[model samples]
Target: MRTGVNLAALATIALAFPSASSAQEWGFPGLGNAEFAAITAGGPAPRRDLTGAWDPGQAGIAGGDNYFNARTVPPLTPLGKEMLSRNRPTHGPYTAKVFEGNDPLTTQGDPSGFPRILNYEFRPMRIVQTPKAVLMLYSFNQSWRIIWTDGRALPQDPDPRWFGYSVGRWEDDTTFVVETVGLTERTWLDSGGFPHSEALRVQERYRRASENVIELTVTITDPLVYAKPWISRDRLPLKKLPEETDFLEQIYAASEVTGFKQNIADKARTQ
Candidate 1:
């Protein structure tokens, strides 16, 4: 139901870094506003059936509770190493606590699932589909972005953001390609707070492999923050309306807090 407040403007802010949680008094400039804008932008409101049903392809492996469970994800190179070294936290499970938003992760903090300083970047992203656009729903920190399928151009010197601006175009019937830019260094690439500079450019290919399944392939290229292009994908089943059970409800009730235990465990080790 939101209206013309400049989708390009909102896009420029989100495609910046990882996700967020609560920035008590830290006025992170465009970050909070971008979050507000994400909640209220776009003209021709997108669809809501993305929660209907979902199917993962046979080739898709079970990413498990933690996709980066110290086993999956690509290895970090020297630049990646440098980024981590420079931003690595002093104590805790992974890095710092700045990545509770933008990053697409679960409530867990340990990306390696190992003990280290934790800069958590875990969030659950929902999907809102329509004939003209696709809205990715983020539950980690109430973060999200609007992918304009109606054809738009990227802004110059955008206001820099945590999630950045995303614009999508259909390659085929079931496939959607999205380009995102205008990010900040304040966020992480995943739950582990894997680093990425503002030069980060994200390209995603989303396709409905079947009637009830959707696959999202992401290609991240940021020469300043990464040595090679970071590639990964995710799968989700559409939560059909007829079988309406609010997944977010369950997540908040207890499942989401499961990650908080890692923080507790981290504290135990430090003591």
Candidate 2:
């Protein structure tokens, strides 16, 4: 219920790059390239700790298109192709007109399910590590997810969930790896509306490359959808924020979208 905010601009920010002025005020003011370089070079990486706010600036936005390495994705299975055809997304290779888009999150205010959440509109996030779990708090949708660190195996046949279940372990002194499964197929793989089945499995590698930088890579595996595993994110760099940094509230509520369609989108369409 943030009022008086320009809904069209918000849509632009989510589907494209935010205006420079808007970027400065949203989610810890993502660092410019020079600033990121300077900060990352300032200190040595700490050991086995990822507790702080992190943002990847424009890099995390995936250019508002196919999030997975678009050029490298294997041909989709027949089922995957059909699912993609059904999705009329406003961004990415198979982009459609805004009015024709049926993006669940954008049009119906649905949760921006797992993988997609990390692949699209990636904003500032805070990571809190505990003995039993790692809590990830995202600026988008004010959402959070937990990556269990208690050494439990993933569920064999779990109920589908928006964010799915996740488990994490340290691959080395500096690399933390997470695996996720049981994701609901209601969500797209990225803003491009790539489809995944409930059988999708996602792996995230978080390497603390420096005190001020964590490099992340995401790999997707879904035999039912993709012919082979492919990378969605390739070592995307996330810069650390000050401990005291605060994030802007960014939520896409149903009523707000409804209002935008009536007052902005519909009117523009008519004009």
Candidate 3:
């Protein structure tokens, strides 16, 4: 009877404590479960930090040189079309090579704003993250943007800025979302001469895909220019750069239009 009792005790132990594999297969709910096991054990997945020098990846737009290459011309309102017609990039479809297109960059202006900065400039960028703000330092024109992440509310009537006022928050552990407004109407939206009014609002979603790659998506909303919101379909994959890569200063100090053309052309040839 003692041997029989020993066998029964073994069976009870087997029934009470399932094997790890069996527990996983049966989808058990507890600290030892597959999905919650790590969390319950006081460990969680590491969050990605977007603090590095990055190179812009392939932006597949035919006959275009920058990020706006693939975007179809928005169904512009009358004012929008008129604004577009006035844009004359040096090498764009509408302008002659000798005629410097009205691109504000031709006048050494700040690449006007976000989409423009991303599209026109091919140099590497560095991101610096802190508790209160994130700073994006561009190699182009030595420009920098400050994205406040300190839980401060966006200003209701902010003074217009060349780069716009930006606020950011983490959407998930891997994704960061930024909203920008109060941009000066003087700047163009892209090197292709897309126009935006002071009423424009830009939404940017940045996701760190891996240690080496980051993906960005931008959506532009301007009731005055387009019939609807314009969200870019292109996934801008930014590849990580070496730690030793230098972001040299790009100063536009040429005073004459001829000097500007010569300087820009020389720089383009090297790139």
Cα deviation in Å at residue 247, candidate 2?
A: 0.4
All candidates' TM-scores? 0.55, 0.85, 0.72
Model 2 clash pairs are none
lDDT of 3 by residue, 112-194 (tens): 46656765554567788898999998776678899999998778888888888899999998799999999887787766677
lDDT of 1 at 137: 48
Off by over 4 Å in 1: 1-79, 89-125, 130-132, 234-243, 249-271
Put the candidates in lDDT order, highest first. Answer: 2, 3, 1
Runs in model 3 deviating more than 4 A are: 1-48, 57-71, 108-111, 254-258, 261-271
Whole-structure CA lDDT of model 2: 0.78
Q: Point out the higher-scoring one by TM-score: 2 or 3.
A: 2
**Cα-based RMSD of the predictions, in order?**
14.0, 8.2, 16.5
For each candidate, the alpha-carbon lDDT, in order, equals 0.46, 0.78, 0.62
- Residues 79-193, candidate 2: write the lDDT tens digits: 9999888998877787777767788888788888899888987888889999999999988888999999999999999999999999999999999999999999999877778
Better of 2 and 3 by lDDT: 2
Candidate 3 lDDT (Cα, whole model)?
A: 0.62
The candidate 2 region of ten consecutive residues with least summed lDDT is 1-10
lDDT of 1 by residue, 1-271 (tens): 3322234533432353123222132212122323432332223322222333111212222223433433444556677677766554322235444332223234332122101011122223356667667776443344456777777787677876756777887777767788988876666664444677778788877665543334566677888755567564544222111112132311332344455545553444431
